[model samples]
Structures are given as C-alpha cells and as structure tokens.
Target chain A: MELFQEVILRTGFLALTWGQLVMWAVGFTLIYLAIRKGFEPLLLLPIGFGILLANIPLTPLMTPGSGLIWRFYHYGLEWEVIPPLIFLGLGAMTDFGPMIANPKTLLLGAAAQVGVYFTFFLALLLKFTVPQAAVIGIIGGADGPTTIYLASKLAPEMMGVCAVAAYSYMAMVPLIQPPVMKLLTTEAERKIVMKSLRPVSKLEKIFFPVVALFVICLIVPDAAPLMAMFMMGNLFRESGVVARLSNAAQNELMNIVTIFLGVSVGATMPAATVLQPKVIFVFILGCAAFMLATATGVLFAKFMNLFLKEKINPLIGAAGVSAVPMAARVVAKLGSEANRKNYLLMHAMGPNVAGVIGTAVAAGMFISVLAK
Target chain B: MVNLESPLSGKILEINMEVGQQVNEDDEVIIIEALKMENPVYCPATGVVKEIKVRIGDQVNEGDILAVIE
Candidate 1:
C-alpha cells in the first residue's frame, strides 16, 4: 500500500500546474498553425514539438547540462551560432539583382527601420529596461533570426518571446501589411507602374557583395559578423564558381541549423518564463512596430517622389520590412488590385532584398549601442 | 561557330527554337527556369541555330552551352 501511494505521488499528473497545461495548449496551437495554416511549418513545427517536450513534468529536457533540448538551447542559441548560420543560408539564396538595378530603393529599406526605433521608445514608455526595449524593438524589422540574435545578446530572458513575436509578425505580413498599406496610400499611388529595371551586368553582380561588405562593415564594425557571412554567401552565389558550396549553404546547412534553432528557441519558453502579461504586451508592441515600419516605408517613398524626376510606385516602399519575398508579394498583390496590368513584383523585390540588409544593420546598431 | 550559353543555372523549361532556324539578335531561343523565375535566353547575336545542345527539363549551370550558333 505504501509503494502504490509512493508511485501515485511521484507521477507527473499530480505535479503539473495550470501554467504548464496552458503552455501545452499553446504548443499544440503552434503545431496546428504550422500544419493546417501552413505558417512557417519548417520552424513552427519543431518549436511546437519542443514546447511539448519542455513542458513535460520533470522531463529535465530544459534543465541545464542534462537535457538534449537544453544543450541545443545553450550551445546553439546561447552561444549565438544558429542565427548567423541562418543568415548565411539567407545570403546564399538571395538575389540582389533587383536592388542592384534600382539603388534608390535602399533608402526605402532604411526608412522602414523607423519601426525599430519607434518601438524601442514605446517599450521604454511601457516600462521595459533599455536592453529589453532594444531587444523588443527589433521585432519591428520582421527578421526572425536577427531579432533572436540581438535578444540573446542583450536580453537573454526575453529571447523566446521576441523570436516568436518577430516570426509570427513575419508570417502575418500578408494580413498586417495590406491593411496598413491600404490605409496609408491612395489608389493612384498603388496603381503607379514602375519602369522595368535595368539588367544588371555579370561583373556588377560579382562585385556588389564584396563592395557592399567593405563599405557597410567599415561603417558599422559591429555588424561585421552577420554582414560578412551574409556577403560571403552571396558572393559564392554570384561568383558562379562555388555552386556546390552555395547549394550546401542554402539547403543542407540551412535545414540542420533551422531545426536546432527552432527547437532551442521553443525550449526557452517554459510556462514559468513565457506565460507572463509581459509577453502579451510584447506581441502588441510587435504589431505596432510592423505597422509603423510599413507606414514609414510607404511615406518615405512618397516623400522621395517629390524630389525625383521619375516617380516610383509608393507601394513598393511597403516591401521594406525584411520579411523577404512575402512583403514584396503583398505589395505586388496590392498594386495589381489597383491596376491589373501593373507588375510590381520585381520592383518591390529591390526594397524587399534591401530590407534584409537594413534590418541587419539596425540590429547591429542596437547591439553596439546597448549590449556593449 | 558562335556558342550560346545559359546566363544562369536552371532547368530548361522550353526550347523555343529548332536547328536550321534563323534567329535574330535579342530573340529568345529558350526559356530557362531559375530560382522559380522563367528567364528567356535570348540569342546574343543574329545567327542560324546550328545545333541545340540541351533538351527540355535538363538542368544547366551558368555559362553551359545551350546551343551552337553558326
């Protein structure tokens, strides 16, 4: 009878708290979103499964030194290895042709980063510490890996929530951006058809990554690690000689790192850490950041049009959120809705690609200013 | 002999020309799909399509000979 009582007392069901049960539900919701809604399945799926594993009572999966997920989190995330590798793959896959074709769109990309600064101040007003606010503000850039990198460095405790907020907002770009974009722009602006981009020469393509690295990194030495790796991967693709290496970087390397990154990030979100009123506020601020970034991009383009001889489609400005192809596609869809004959995909890609670099630079600035 | 090569690596989606066909400069000779975008491979010089070296769905690398122009 004593043995039976001991066994019952030791079982997980007896020890599990309501907070853990709520976290499990959140995990399952992430799984459902990944599978059914197709929202960043590669990332969200592993993260969801990791959440379930981490929440299991007395599993020790998230405990220091003993758990596999914990090891992944500590070594991969805490050491800051995964996000930069993800940037490597991102660089390998990105084509800067559109951005090279229209150098002016780089300004739009810079303009969109206004959200990061704006959110930083807002988070401070909401009573977050300077470091926490800096970490939270990066959620506006809509670049998941960069956000994770900055948060892990400056505010380790906020890493999981900030990553989730950045990624969820990125996935929600199609929904969040369109409403803000529509509200900010007139039909005439949306319907503005951009002229076809000039074809970039092969030599120019080969030179861009190198020249960009030298100039940008020289200016912001803090951004060198991410920027150097990013530009190196791009040079591999553009140089056309290291195809095998580029392929590995984009496919095998990226997939393995993503699995580690997603699971580790999810493991960080145990019930005790994640189920806070602060998280909800972070999400609210994150959405505001995205909206502000989008609005700033559009408005900047409109402002620039006043000085330029050839006007740009202000809609392309909204693509400057570093959500990669999704933000650009949203701009294209909105443009087409205004004018069916208008093709804005390639044009938007210029700013879309530029946004990735812009976000990295912004993250670097935050890290240098705050973390140092 | 003038060699017409693919400017980018991709799968040959469609071959738009045949051997012995007269081609003009800037005329698309083949459509190559790379990075999910279909790029039209235009004839760089006005010439006769002497031979087609690639077929539909063949994976090509940058600067691979797609056709030989005479």
Candidate 2:
C-alpha cells in the first residue's frame, strides 16, 4: 500500500500545480500562434516547445547544476554569447547600401530612440525599478537580441516575459503601425515618391563598418561586445574574399545559436518567476513602447520635411522602429497603396537597418548609466 | 521577348496566370510573399505569357524573371 501511494505521488498528474497549468496554456498558445498563425515561427516555435519541457513535473531540464537547458542558459545567455552571435549573423546578411546611399535617413533612426526614453519614464511611473524599466523600454526598438541582451543584464528575472513581449509585438507590427501611420500622414505625403537612392560604391561599402566601428565604439564603449561582432560580420561580407566565413556566419552558425537562444530564453520562464503580476505589466508596457516608437518615427520624418527641398515619404520613417525587413515591407505596402509608382522597399530599408544600430546604442546607453 | 521580372525578392505565393494566357499592364498577376506579407506584382506589359519561369512557393530574387511575355 505504501509503494502504491508512492507510485501515485510520483506521477506527474498528481504533482501538477496551478502555475504549471497556466504556463502550459501560455506555452500551447505560443505554439499555436507560431504553427497556425505563423507569427515569428523561427523563435516562437522553439520557445513554446521549451516552455513545455521546463514545466514537466520533476524534469531536470532547467535545474541549476545538472539540467540540459541550464547549461545552455548559463553559457549561451548568462555568460553573454548567444545574443551577440545573433547580431553577428544579422550583420553578415545586412546590406547597408540604402543607409549608406542616403545617410540623412539615419536621423530618423535616432529619432525612434525617443520612444525608448518615454516608455522608460512610463514604466518608472508605474513603480518598476530603474533597471526593470530600462529593459521594458527597449521593446520599443523591436530588436529581439538587444532586448534579450538587456534583459539578461538589467533584469534577469524578467528575461523570459520581456523577450516574449518583444517578439509578440514584433509580429504584430503590421496591425499596430498602419493606424498610427494613416492618422499622422495625409494621402499626398504618402504618395510623394522620393528620388531613387544613389548606387553605393564598393569602396564605400567596405569603409562603412570600419568607420562606424571606430566612431560608435569611441562614443559608447559599453556596446563594444555586440558592436565588434556586428562590424566583424559586415567586414566578412564586404571583403569579397571570405565567402565561406560569411556564409557560415549567416547560415549554419546562425541556426545553431537561434535554437539554443530560443530554448534557453523559454526555460527561464518556468512558473515561479513568470506568473508574477509584473509579467502582465511587461506585455502592456511593451505594446505601448512599440506604438510610441512608430508614432515618433513618423512624426520625426514630417518634422524633417519642413526643412528639406526634396520631400520624403513619412511612411518610411515608421520603418525606423526596426523589425528589419518585416517593418520595411509594411512601409512598402503602405507606400504602394498610396501610389503604385512608389517602390519604397529599397528606400525604407535605410531606416530599417539604421534602426538596428540605433537600438544597440540605446541598450548600451542604458547599460552605461545603470549597470554597476 | 519582354521578361516579367520580380521587383522584390520573395516566395511566390501565387501565380495568377499560366503560360499562353493573355495579360495586360497593371494586372496583378502574381503575388510574392515576403516577410509574411503578400505583395502583388503587376504585369510589366500587355502580352500573352509565353513561359512561366516560376511557380507558386518558388523564391525569386529581385529582377529574376517570373515569366516571359511576347
């Protein structure tokens, strides 16, 4: 009879708690969103599967010393390897041609950072600590690696939820951005097609990452780890002699790190930390941050137009919020709808890529000011 | 031959016309899905599609010929 009771107690069904159940629902929902709705499936799918793994009763998947996921989390994230590696992959694939061709669009990228500060204050008003608020504000930048990097540093406990919020908002960019974009700009402004970007010379392409590395690192030394890897990857692509290294960085190495990064981030959630009331607040604040970023980007472009001789499409400014090609495509759709003649894909890409650098700078600034 | 080139690189979500089908300029004959958004690629000029170089779900880079019109 004692052995029978022990067997019953050992079964996972008897050991299940409300928190685990809740997390399962969350995990399954994320999985459904990824598989059915196709919402950032690359990250969300692994993350959802990891959530299920960590919640299984008595599993050592995330147990500190001996667990499989624990090792991934410890080395890949806590020791700061995965996110920077992801940035390296991004840099390898990035074409800075558009941004290099029209450097003025970089101002639009800088303007989007205003939303991060504004969201930071909002989180502070709602009673989050300075470091906690800083992590929340970066969701506005819409770069998942930067968000995870900042979360890992400023508030490790909040990492899982904050990363989830960032990815969710990123997938929702099309739904959230168009209303604000339409509200702020008239049809004429959207239809006003700017001149095509000048072809950036190969020399300029080779020189960009080098110059940016020197200037940005000098200003924000705290960002050097991520900045260095990013610039290195770009040089590999542009040097025209390292196709093998560039391909590996952007493809094979990238895929391996993405799997580990997703699973490790999801493992951090478990029930104990992620079930807190603060988690919900992270999602709410993240949405507000993203919307504010989009609004500011569009508004800033209109503000810039008051001085420029050749008018720019304000829609492209919203791409400065930086979900990479996703955000740029949204702006492209909006531009074409307003006028079929507008081919804003290449143009919007300038601010879209610039936004990545802008957000990295914001994360570095936060780290410099707040991290001891 | 007038080649109907893709303006953007993306997966061909749908090819609205087949070979030997008549098409007109500005006809939204092919849809390319890039980053989960469906973008309609208009017919570049009026002609019958002599050969369809791409099919649904094929990835085509910018300037890749989707079809040849003559």
Candidate 3:
C-alpha cells in the first residue's frame, strides 16, 4: 500500500494546478490560431508548443538549468544572441532600393515612432519603471525583434509579455491597421496616386549601407550593434560579391534563430507570470500604440503634402509602422480599392523599409536615455 | 557592340524589343521580376538588337547576358 501511494505522489496529476490547466488551454489556443487562422505560424507554432511543455506540472522542460526550454531561453534570449542575428537576416532580405529612390519617405518612418513615445508616457502613468515602460512603448514600432531585444535588456521579466504583444499586434496588422487608416484619411487622400520613383543607380545602392551605417552609428552609438549587423547584411546583399553569405543569412541562419527565439520566448510565458493585470495592460497599451503610430504616420504625410509639389497617397504613410510587406501591402490594397489604377505597393515600400531603420534608432535612443 | 545583362535574379516577365529592332539608350528592354517587385532592364546604348538570349518566363541571375546589341 505504501509503494502504491508513492507512485501516486510521483504522477503528474497529483501536482497539477488550475493555473497549469489554464496555460495548457492558452497553448492550445495559440496552436489553433497558428494552424487554423494562419497567424504568425512560424513563430506561434513553436511558442505554443513550448508553452505546453513548460506548463506541464512535473515536466523539467522549464527548470532553471536542467530544462531543455530553459536552456534555449537562457542561452538564446538572456544572453541576447538571437535577436541581433535575426536583424542580420532581416537586413539580408531587405531591399533598400525604394528608400534610396525617394529619400523623403524617411520622414514617414520617423513619424511612425510617435506611438513609442506616447506609450512611454502612458506606461509611466500606469506605474511601470522607466526601463519597463520604455520596453513596452517600443511595441508601437511594430518590429518584433527590436521589441524583444529592448525588452530583454530593459525589463527582463516583462520580455515574454512584450514579445507576445509586439508579435500579436504585428500579426493583427491586417485587422487593426485598416480601420485606423480609414478613420484618419479622406477618400481623396487615399485615392491620390503619386508619381513613379526615379530608378536608383547601382552606385547609390552600393554606397547607401555604408553611409547609413556611419550616420546612424555616430548619432546613436547604443543602436550600433543591431544597426551594424543590419548594415553589414545589406552590404553583403548589395555588394553582389558574397551570394553564399547572403543566402545563408536569409535562409539557414534566419530559420535556425527563429526556432530558438520562438521556443525560448514561449518558455517565458508561464501562467504565474503571464496571467496578471500588467500583462493585460500591456496588450491594451500595445493596441493603442499601433493605432497611434498608424495615425501619426498618416498625419505626418498629410503635413508633408502641404509643402511638396507632388502629392503622395497618405495611405502609404500607414506603412511606416514597420510591419514590412504586410503594412505596405495593406496600403496598396486600400489604395487600389480607392482607385484601381493606382499601384502603390512599390511606393509604400520606401516607408515600410524606412520604418525598420526608424524602430532600431528609437530603441537605441531609449537605451541611451534610460538604461544607463 | 553592347552586351545587355540582367541586374538582378528574377523571372523574365516580358521582353519589350525584338531581335534586329532599333533601340535607344535607356529604353526599357525587358522586365525582370524578383521578390514580387518588377524591375525594367534598360539598354546600355543606342544600337540595333542583334540577339535575344532570354525569353519570357526564363529565369535569370545577376549579370546573366540577356541581349546583344550592335
């Protein structure tokens, strides 16, 4: 009878709690969204699976040293190896031709960062520490890796929630952006078709990364690590001499780092930590940040139109939130709906790519200001 | 003689000139598409199109010869 009792005590069922059960349900929901809804599947699938593994009562998957997921989280995230490498991959894949063709769109990118500062103050009002608030505020930039990078540095405990919030908002771009975009711009503004961009010269394309790197690094040394990696990746791609390195950066390196990043980020989402009022507030503030960022971009474009001779479709301004091709595509689609003849995809790409640089700069600024 | 090559890797979406056609410098010669963006390949010099090397839907890489002009 004593032996039987020992076996019962050792079983997982004996140690299970309601919180763990709820976390399992959360994991299942994330998996369902990834599979059924196709929401950020590459990252969400691993994250969901990791959450499930971590939440199991007797599992060692998330223990300090012995746990597999914990090892991935500690080495990959805590040490801050993955996010910058992901930036390298992003730089490899990014094409700066559009931004080079039209230098003015950089303003739209800067404009989109308004939400970051707005949310910074809002988080302070909500009683988060300066560093924690800065991390939360970066969700406005709508760049997942930057958010993860900043959160891991500034507010380690809030890293998982902020990463989730940033990605969820990124995935929800199609749903969240259209309403804000429509509410902000008039039909005429949306329908306005801008002129085609001048073709950028090969020499300009080759020169851009070096010049950009020099300027950004000099201005914001704190952002140099990510900026340097990103610029180096861009240099590899544009220099056209290192196809093998560029290909590896874009494909194999990106895939490997993404897997580690997703699972490790998931491991941070234990029910005890994730199910709090602060987490909920983070989500709400995240939505607000996205909306505000979209609005500010559109507004800034409108402001620029007042001075420029050739008018731009204000819808493209919404692409400044750094959701990359998705936000740009959304602007293109909306522009087409407003006027089928207007093709805005290429034009929107200028600001879309610019937003990536802008977000990195903003994170660097925050780190410079607050982390010290 | 002028050698025409694609500036990037992509599928040839269209060829705007025929062999033996007269072309001006900077004329849009072909459309190469990569990463869902279309790039127009231009002629380097005013010349007669001597040969067309790539067809519509042909996959090309950077610096691959696409045409010969004389």
List the DockQ of the predictions in order.
Answer: 0.06, 0.26, 0.06
Docking outcome class, model 2: acceptable
Tens digits of per-residue lDDT for model 3, A40-82: 9998888888788878888888889888888998898889799
lDDT tens digits by residue: candidate 1, A279-354: 8999999999999999999999999999988999999999999998889878877887897556577788899989
Worst 10 residues of 1 chain A by lDDT: A336-345
Q: What C-alpha RMSD separates each model from the true structure? A: 5.8, 3.8, 6.0
- The best candidate by lDDT is 2
TM-score of chain B of each: 0.94, 0.94, 0.97
Interface RMSD of each: 7.2, 3.2, 7.5
Better of 2 and 3 by DockQ: 2
lDDT of 1 by residue, B1-70 (tens): 7898776556999998999999988786788775455666778789899999999999986568999988
DockQ category of candidate 3: incorrect
Candidate 2, B42: how far from true, in Å?
5.8
In model 3, the runs with Cα more than 4 Å from the true position are B1-70
